[model samples]
Target: MSDTATRPEGRRVDRTSAPQQGSWTTARIVKLVAILAAVVVLLVLPLYVEEFWLRTGFAVFAAIIGALGLNLLVGTTGQLSLAHAFFLAVGAVTYTYVSGTSGGTANAYGGLEWPPLVGMVLGVLVSGLAGIIFSPIAARLRGIYLGIASLGLVFIGQHVLNTWTSVTGGFNGRLVPAFSLFGFSFGGTDSPELVIAGVPFGQTERLWYLGLALCVVACWFANNLVRSRPGRALQTLRDSEVAASVMGVDVRSYKARAFLVSSMYAGMAGVLYALSIGSVAPDSFGLALSVQFLAMIVLGGLGSVTGAILGATFVSSAPLVLQQYAGSLPFIVDPGQPGIVASQAAAFLYGGAIVLVVMFEPGGLAGLARRLRPTTRAPGAAIAADGADSSQHSTPAPADPSTGGDNR
Candidate 1:
């Protein structure tokens, strides 16, 4: 019945009195349940939601991936970059060029007609390669200088996308080839004639699952990376590069690695973006797109993965949902109409939200959530928490006479 343990040194330590890491507490159980419920809802959402909502969900998933990637670089590593759109373009352009059919009249385009899977993989790799190539520049620069340097990539990419018509299809853009795994085509309507709970699985529905799977994988990897050694090193570097260097952290190497990983994530998101729109245009990967991603991480909370997801969902979906319900919503009008357009309205809303977050809660939504969470510790646990808090702030105790100041 006792939670105390006797050590070989005749010392009694309270085990349960102090909260154990990873132990299943009431809050942990509730959190686990909530996560499982959310997953179930997402999995079955396609069965109930219409095509438009499914399409929007897929777009949100892609945004989440992109936001997470940016957070790793800017939020965790403290490396400012405005070239996310360029990386996304690289992935989209690479995928389209590699898998597309070679034919056109006025605007000639070319392709190798490779498998979609291969194209997707190559897209991610090429994006990462591009990131690594630019990592040296990223490594040397910091703050807005790095951002400005990265911004040049977007312009260069735009010019290449326009001038290199054979690969990019020029300003007109090229149609993105549908993603497929083996014989199963994600874009096809009746490839296998699948049905789920009486809901016919169309292209939208199929792509929804693919996006969901990729989003989950991306989030999972990011979460793990943030808790790993390299992640800690990056965070350390972010806090103080001099300190990190003193701690034996390879500053430049880690910076390069972060760029590599983050760009690859942007690449994956790019492929999804292309698939979502069914096309890749130079205009789509512009300065505005990069700013939007920056907004996502800032609004979500820089170093928090969950914040990135929350931020991405709100930022990506607000405009679409507003446009979808423009007729019913007040002061929201269609394009070329009288009042504010849905896109402008959505931007205003999030811009105000960002300003408020910056003033009141610099940690963004994640910090707000943490502050709002209920503290439901048991009495012993409360004592332990108090002790931990006191220990953090209290001055060091005098050295013991017998131990010679070697407490350990």
Candidate 2:
């Protein structure tokens, strides 16, 4: 009797001594709460912030949307892309050409005047169509092959925009009228304009809201996608193409779908970019721009959408912010006419960041955030902490199966 009583007490005591496994971990409940909080903040943010910051925030959102799209197709689907920026150009040019056109021949990619809506639709559709056509090649290639193939599209896109002077206005690009919704131009100076205290929201702020709206839609869709049958099929290919094929997953079709989805998102993003600037220049969508997009996806992590957004935000903002600050720094080189510190330095830093993130963290900002999360006796923390411990005893992959599959 004494032994039985003592044993039971001891067991209870031991259980009490140990921490709850899920208690400190990040739960789906916590994530939902955090997301809700973020949304609330975003809504309230524009109300209090100035026009410039509003634009800045919106730019971040646009980049996030585009990067999130890339993460889905490339991160989960394991496709390499280098022509996303060109797709962006397509969107910008298409939107502008459409807005400024007289129902007759509006300028298009190669100077084929098209109707506005038609031009926008055609631009996006053409990009998607290109994805399908390029799929067979994407199917045959991996790594550098896909990259090289995509690079060719960059030059082709540049040539099309440059040579098709009638449509793209050759090297000059085109001016775009403000994007309107429901008869209200986003930032128009007219009565329906977005104004607060006599300061109307500029093109950037208006475009930002447009971008945010699109981002919400994109994220919602992507969230559903990675959880659905199609998303599962994508992961099946990423992990083991042979296994996926053996399972009757049409790998070629999946890869093509990834490209198509990514391009579509890029196309939409281009619209916002053009609207924000109120103009489009061929130089804005150059080969270097494509490389930057690649760097964004890579640094953000291949398959994580949140990571993609974070990466895009940083990539897009870092340079401009740095250049502004660099000007105040003493002994900085005048990169401008007698200018010392130039935007070029920002690009160099961005490149260096890419290398460091790739070689060292691989998971980028998302990974860093995960690492910094306290593992204080929580549920998900157990796995994270377990893996952290296991990392010392065994070599582990940079991403977990769960996170690696998250498209957004």
Candidate 3:
């Protein structure tokens, strides 16, 4: 007998004809395998990579955090901000001052000598506070006006960094205190030695792992934030403030909150930047720095978490890599060599890339990735499957007696 059940209306239904649930398609299995393989490669890379590359990796990690933050504000929330460098400076300077010891010499500097963790936490808080304070102004402006208003913060921060001699070390800058956790250091050669697979884990290696962990956490948090309800609200706000307001989303409040959260992420990135460079200088956190971050989000694709990471990696690493290999490359030379310097060359390359991406692929790298991804089924396959199932399982309805004949 056919595997069917009779309904009250004299119709037969085939329970087995339903589509399969939770079945692992070939595309899904391939994606899972690819992700696992990439994770393994990232985990093992520090063991075999050189110290220079490890240092570059740490810088990339810091940039990734910063880019993610910028993407959330400008990309996801449709807020234009150029004060990111100011917030970064706030975090870096706070960490340096809170954790560093006073300079006993003529150019004296201040310090709290607190635990590094405390310094880090305070750095993030102070940066967030700065953002919160400026958020009111941000809520009042939009587009280039908001961006221009935010740009003022960078100048203000620069002035403070230069004149606040005791805290910021004046024009020359101050050393960043080494980070330690309960006496275990992630900086310097004096920390307890660690051996992994016959390779001595030095300061670079230790910092590499630390950076990796932090980057992972940053990515995870940003991904979750982008997928949450508030994320949807932010997207709505980006699309149309009136629509968002009608939907009961507090536009001003969310804008303020976005600034606060983005600033906090910049703070974390700033702390890592201080660690990577071993110093906090006023000249380092300038308008150019803010512009670089803007380039990152734009190149990576606005509103994409993965795109932020990719853009950060490219923008952060390009100049360094070009500088490293400049001697062998044509048309590129060292500073003052009367040729295209590595930094300038790198800028041209990415600037051109941005133009191309804008012209050809408006969605950026993330959208390109989606376009290239394999589909689980052929075109029209799902429709065909549904039709086949309906033909096999669904029964013709009973004739309408009231109409005195079949309606068909």
**Which is the leading candidate under TM-score?**
1
TM-score against native, each model: 0.91, 0.79, 0.88
Give each model's whole-structure lDDT.
Answer: 0.91, 0.72, 0.90
Backbone atom clashes (below 3 Å) for every candidate: 0, 19, 0
Model 1 lDDT tens row, 1-408: 887876544445687677667778888799879888988999999998899999999999999999999999999999999999999999999999888886664225668999999999999999999999999999999999999999999999999999988889988999887888988999855467888788989899999999999999999999999999999999999999999999999999999999999999999999999999888989999999999999999999999999999999999999999999999999999999888999999999999999999999999988889889987767667776776676677666666779988756
Residue 43's C-alpha lDDT in candidate 1? 94
- Say which prediction, candidate 1 or candidate 2, comes out ahead on lDDT: 1
User: Which ranges in model 2 have alpha carbons more than 4 Å from their true place?
Assistant: 1-26, 102-122, 191-204, 330-335, 338-342, 376-408
- Superposition error at 376 for model 3 (Å): 2.7
List model 3 lDDT by residue over 213-311, tens digit each.
Answer: 898899889989999999999999999999999999999999999999999999999999999998888999999999899989988899999899988
> Native-vs-model 1 lDDT?
0.91
Residue 110 of model 1: what lDDT?
68
Most accurate candidate by lDDT: 1
Please give the distance, in angstroms, between residue 145's alpha carbon in candidate 3 and its true position after superposition.
Answer: 1.1
**Residue pairs with clashing backbones, model 3:** none
